[model samples]
Target: MSRKENAASLVQDYAEVFICPVCGDTVEVVELKSVVCPKRHTFDFAKQGYINISTRSMKVNYDKELFAARENIIMKHKLYDPLHTRLLEVIKVEAANNPRSLLLDAGAGEGSHLAKILDQMKTVTGIGIDISKEGIRLAASKSEKAMWLVGDLANIPVKDQSLHTIINILSPANYQEFKRVLIENGLMIKVVPGANYLIELRDTILEEQKRFFTNEETISLFKQHYSDVQIEELTYTKELHQEELRDLIKMSPLSWNAEQESINEVRNREHFGITIDLAILIGKNR
Candidate 1:
């Protein structure tokens, strides 16, 4: 089947999980082409195989090139293999008593992270939602296993208390919206950057301002929004060639504000060693 057909099939199978972005009414797949709600708010699936369910217009800085670089770094370079493994381990432990029927990857950029995690599981169905149409389109092109959609985090286009698990990785979070979609006692795994994450890149491009960072404020905020909060720290380094380093620089936000000279200097290096430090937070709904 084509990507559109496959996406339609998946949407039909899990139609009950969706809601109209405008009216908040239950949604249904219509004739395998579109989703419609009782109040007549409708969204059509794109030819690329993803649905656009966003309610309002918003500016997004991420572009197609950024997602392409990210895909190469995550899927081809395998820099995030350790992180994915840890996530899988956590998911298994946290949901030991219940079956992980459905998982929502909020702010799922290019869908690589979600795709990687779902690859190891046999029964879990994943829904990758992102505000960037470019990211969602690229994601849909790569995988038909998970449903990809262009959606806003402020108003997730999913039913209340419907998700079995929610994973947020290196993306913004809407805790209230997440709580609304997550089932009672459901699992939430959030990954935040550690103090020394990408220290090499920071030193090269960020200079003096590249001093060790902290996620204390973020951790405190998460604890306030979530219950049974637990943190797991994973730190490591990966060797990257010039091309890989270029892609990494393009994919990360740290280089966004750096001077072109600094970015060029880092990317032109023969080989670079980069640190991957992350704090994985696990929590459950009350």
Candidate 2:
């Protein structure tokens, strides 16, 4: 069997804690005990330490190359690190001691952000759902500590009111599904680029389309669904080498529409630096 076929539960150790995704009831885990709701819904926690929380299929064209670009950019500390660090700090401070706090990463690509958050909190489990199977496969390969599924963000697979924190990292949001799965005071965190974000890279990729999102506009959307909306813009500059710079260009959606030859030219150019205008929004589900 290939490594893909050999994927299994990360461990057999589990606490006496479980939640019914349908009714939002708390359940206990006994040895060899599979999850069974009062309504007779049963979900067995795989030995691989994850769950299949997606109810429907979501099709997409993302392949290994896309997931690699995402992972490479993240590892280089150029684009995602600042936002990723903020997420870890927020979860540790706000939702640390809940008897049960399920972290659902809506557009989790390769499961890096969710995995980092899990490491920061002592007792937390996460479900990473992506539209691409290749993304989940890479995540599962990295650590059996988290669960990965091939699903879409618009339609989540878990029970209602079952989450403590939900992270949308440069991904799409399904606010209605989020409201259903969150407690009254549960938090939703989002990271989007500021208008001037990655201008250097955009110079080559954005052909006067102006695709940057407005922080206030996003805040308004969140306000439409969630209350106590708070928005902060983090601006920082990073130094980069040629290889790291090349990876950043390869991984972004901006590169997708660019001519392949032009992309190659940009990738081959020498060392460069880019300023990142990252906006973070955190709020409650009203």
Candidate 3:
């Protein structure tokens, strides 16, 4: 089957969870090519298989090349393998409580992380949503296991109390919308950068003030919204070759503002030692 057909089928299976982006009504799959709501707000599946479910046009800084670079760093270099493993373990604990799970990877960029997690899961239905069409397009091209959509975080396209788990990794969070879409006691696994995250790149490319990192305010805000909040700190160093180091620089926003000479300096390294320091916050919806 084509990606469009496969996406339609996936949406059909989980149509109950999706709502019309414009009218706020339940959506239905029609003619295997489009989704229509009661008020006739129709959205067609793109040729690449992902649907654009946002009400307005969006232009994001994360382009196709950026996503490609990110995919290379994550998939080829296995830079995030340990983090993915821990995410699977956390999701499994929640999956055991519920026989079947509907997981949404909010702000899922390129869907690599969600695709990897879904591969290890047997009974979880995965949905990946991002505002960047380029990221969602790249995601749809990779895996048909999850439903991919270009969506707004503040106005999520999913229905209320419908999700069993939400995984937000190194991405912004819309806590109010997230809580509205999650069922009672649903899991929220949020990963934020720790003080030493990407210290190698920061030290080389960023300003002194920008080199410092902290998530204390982020954690405190999260605690106010979630119950049974637990934080896990994962820290490690990964050795990178020249090409991997280049891709890492391309994929990170830390290098976005750096001078080309500084970027070139990091890219031209013979061997680079990078630190992956992150805090994983696991919590339940109140």
For candidate 3, lDDT tens digit of each residue in 69-99? Answer: 9999888898999999999998998888776
Task: Itemize residue pairs with steric clashes in candidate 1.
Answer: none
Number of the top lDDT candidate: 3
lDDT for 157 in candidate 2 is: 52
In candidate 1, position 35 carries an lDDT of: 89
Best by TM-score: 3
**Taking the candidates one at a time, how many backbone clashes does each contain?**
0, 7, 0
Q: TM-score for every candidate vs. truth?
A: 0.96, 0.80, 0.98
User: TM-score ranking from best to worst?
Assistant: 3, 1, 2
Candidates in order have lDDT scores of 0.88, 0.68, 0.91
Worst 10 residues of 1 by lDDT: 91-100
How many Å off is the CA of 220 in candidate 1?
0.5
lDDT of 1 at 128: 94
TM-score of 3: 0.98
